[model samples]
Target: MDNDRAFMLSHTFLLKSVKPFGEGLWQPGASGAPWRSDAAEPTADDCVCSIAIFTEEPGTIDLDGTSVSLSKGSAIQLRSGGRFSVQSGSGSATGRLAGWLVEFFVFRFGDSRPIAGGFPLLPYHQEIAVHPFAALCSVVDRITRTADGYDDPTALRKQAALLELLALLMENQQRSHMLDNAAAAVKRAISYVRDHYTEPLTVEQLASIAGVGRWQFSELFRRLTGKRPLDYINTIRLNRAKELLLLTDDPLREIAQSVGFRDEYYFNRKFSRMFGCAPKSFARSGKTAASRQPLLPAAKQARVRSSLTGEPSRLVVCGGILGDVLSLGVKPLGAELAVMGRQVVYRDKLAGILDVGIGGDADTIAALQPDLVLLEKEGVAASHFQSAAAPVVSFRRTEDVTVRLRAIAALLGAEREADEWIARHEDAASSMWNRLRSRIGTGETATVLVQIGVQLFVMGNRGLAATLYHPRGFSSSEGAAKLAEGSERFREITAEQLPGYDGDRLFLLFSGDERSKREARQLTETSAWQSLHAFRSGNIHMTEAKWNYDDSLTRGQLLPVLPHILSSRI
Candidate 1:
């Protein structure tokens, strides 16, 4: 289809002047005014259009042979030569329909483009949303008020109002069309992922199928599915592997390869992290008892019984609580490091710690003969760690850093260290908030956005959110508050949702990954982002991606420097 002939009309039409022929408000019903003439009107040489807004109740209209149903706040247009009729209600029901109508022609200023040549096959019907519906109604009211004076001195103002109405209609149509296309494309991509999950896949390849940029594909995928593309793929692979572990006697390496994973060791680590138990252990207990009993070797079970003691000397950290454990002055034998290892806030303190990769390898952890194992509630299960022949203690990563710190301290017999860390953090936070009170409002709202890969998230009660949302400091925006109330640490959102979630102040969090930085820059350049109040007022701030981690070390580090970052912007 020609660009000018589609719902997204060309800019050339915008250059022409909108000249009104007639305008009126009418109701169609048993006793209401008639919309059509007694006889059918023939096509005219002049290119003209009739626009209508359904103000009350539902209605049906026939443009040529196509039937369109219009609900309240719906807008439609018809070309001069088209066969059209309007009636109240839909289908067999006869009811009342109230609306405003305007007939207009676009007069060319200088260019001689054929106005009648590009009328859309059938006019598009759009349902205006609450905000834009009011704007459209206000413009229509202006046109109605000025209809009588079209030939008088106020003609220019009336023409301008008509142009505004056209602009609003076009803008709404384009936005709605884009949103629909994006959603459909993402759905197609998801369907492809599920059908061909065993095949190798890449973001670029999936985006090609979706007909979108990789960055946009990533964001939309997360917004719609609540998981990153790779993560989702891994979930599929891991689930299939779990079923194989129960249904067959295949070796671990064969099972891993059959489910798209190339390395048996990598598969083992991910399996342990996701289900909290190794595949061998999960298989040993059978499907019925898997969750309840992750059996260990006889020797390891004996070792576990002997190690549940007053103080644990050797520790294996299997989750994010590594930071809290370190803060309490206890270093573990091994720890699961994040993918961005060099950027971790506590990287300097991990001098001799074994890098067990993310979610720690159960076999490697067990081989270390650790007396105790620390795991996160969301990560590798405590039973998995127990099967490693160590006393396992798990903490919810979403808990306040102080609470987690103290719990780790008590486990390690270092209560003094936990108290000192808490005291230091509290005093620093109080001092920072007090010093900047005059610079910031009493309850100035703030929102934190973090970019991971190409996905953007509204930080909830984790990471930088925990650091920023103190009673004496910045308050969470309405959108941020709602997200914090949920269990997820962050909520993925599209660019169009920025206005609703945006606050008085904005913080953009990005990781050291080049892709994440590029995504952040692209986000700031978008119209939705640039139009935000925080962006316009220069109240946007930056927090490194490392600081976005939900850990005691990151939270403690944010306390002192965050004041300077915000005060400088103010």
Candidate 2:
């Protein structure tokens, strides 16, 4: 933030021939070999600092015991008193290392004069872009070419070249720093919006929170959220108003004020524009639906919070694991709405939660400033969430549902809830299975067959198979168990192989697409399908194909439904 200081390079020496000594303003050092396995590599000194630029096939630099890869056109700025060595004999066709080492001290202009600002260092392995690299290499060439003689003009030429090199480094540093600052500012501003949307807000205030000018802040905000600051704020307000319309019976004026709207007139216009109806009309429609019956189980009211903060912890679910977190009685701040062509069974429970797309990215997650991020392993990279400056815990979507629930609860600091929920689920499952024993015997084998288009796969350890194959309920057929031995969730097989995997009971699922449904009907008519013991005995249960998840929420919802499905078949 200070504008009083500017960086400069001073006391320059080119270490080409011999190691330089004393404080020579423009001294060309004695002959020395380039950094390589066969040469004497440079080491850090408490009294000196240096920058090394490599141009040939690169090697690794061991700085203070950390191996850093050196690429062509990349530079390393060495700090004082760190051990430095280069590993040689790889990465180049000629097996030679070509690099230039420039030793200098950094100074800052203070009070209209130069002051020592210590030896400023760049990152350990910063790669210089092509244009800058060429510019830097050209300056280095000029410095080296002019430094051979010790005359006054020759020294001036070397100093001029060094000054240009320093300018290039400083400019790059400033540009990089500006970009980083912009991202951090946008993140902070968006977080402020989330935490304080109900209060008075202004573009200038938000920009101030980001520590940048208003224009810059707006540009960065739109880049991340695809909307101007005012537009985004309106979106959050409108969504909250929608939730209130369904969950409470407050008047339009009161609801508008509660969600930061200036008055009912503005709220009415915005609501009408966004949802294609006036506020009162939308509420009437919702009330009519509720009169018929509660559309969904009321969302858990008690929010999950951090023990450290006591206030509800802002959370983001970046993968299909939203169901796991929801099962633990924690509604995340944001979640992926759906996956695999079906909405989550508890989609109605996602009121007031932002849809963070299918898989979240660094900028969006960072903007939320969540206390923690719950991510699923598939289709998400844990590193991306880590860069959001939040703690991230990843779970495999296909892992045991109980294991995933416990892990998520632990991340949320809600272990007791997970334990209690699992106990209750087990009890419910036991009761459901017990009631079905009269029609479906224990230890009877079952297989899940799924038809999507022309392909058929046996559900192995994942999806419905996870719900069906319980010690007290049913077991997988021998062939299905063999398929489950592999790591994949399902295995594709031909119709001829269907009989081998057939069991005493079958759960036949087909995709909802018209083509897949037609294929399923065709498969059912084939002799291979008609010969199956389950099919012949009328034990085949047809269910919606998309209910193939093993998340805790899905499993809980299915416990009561499974009995109805089995009994209907009987």
Q: In candidate 1, what residue range of length 10 has the lowest lDDT sum?
A: 21-30
lDDT of 2 by residue, 69-104 (tens): 555555666654455555432322232445666665
Candidate 1 root-mean-square deviation in Å? 21.6
Best by lDDT: 1
Best candidate, TM-score: 1
Candidate 2 residue 246 Cα shift, in angstroms, is 42
Off by over 4 Å in 1: 1-313, 338-340, 377-379, 513-515, 567-570
- Note the clash tally of each candidate: 1, 5
Q: Write the per-residue lDDT of candidate 1 for residues 239-335, one digit (tens) a residue.
A: 7687667546789999999999988999999999987788999777544332233334456655543443323336788767777877776767788
The ten-residue window of minimal lDDT in model 2 covers: 18-27
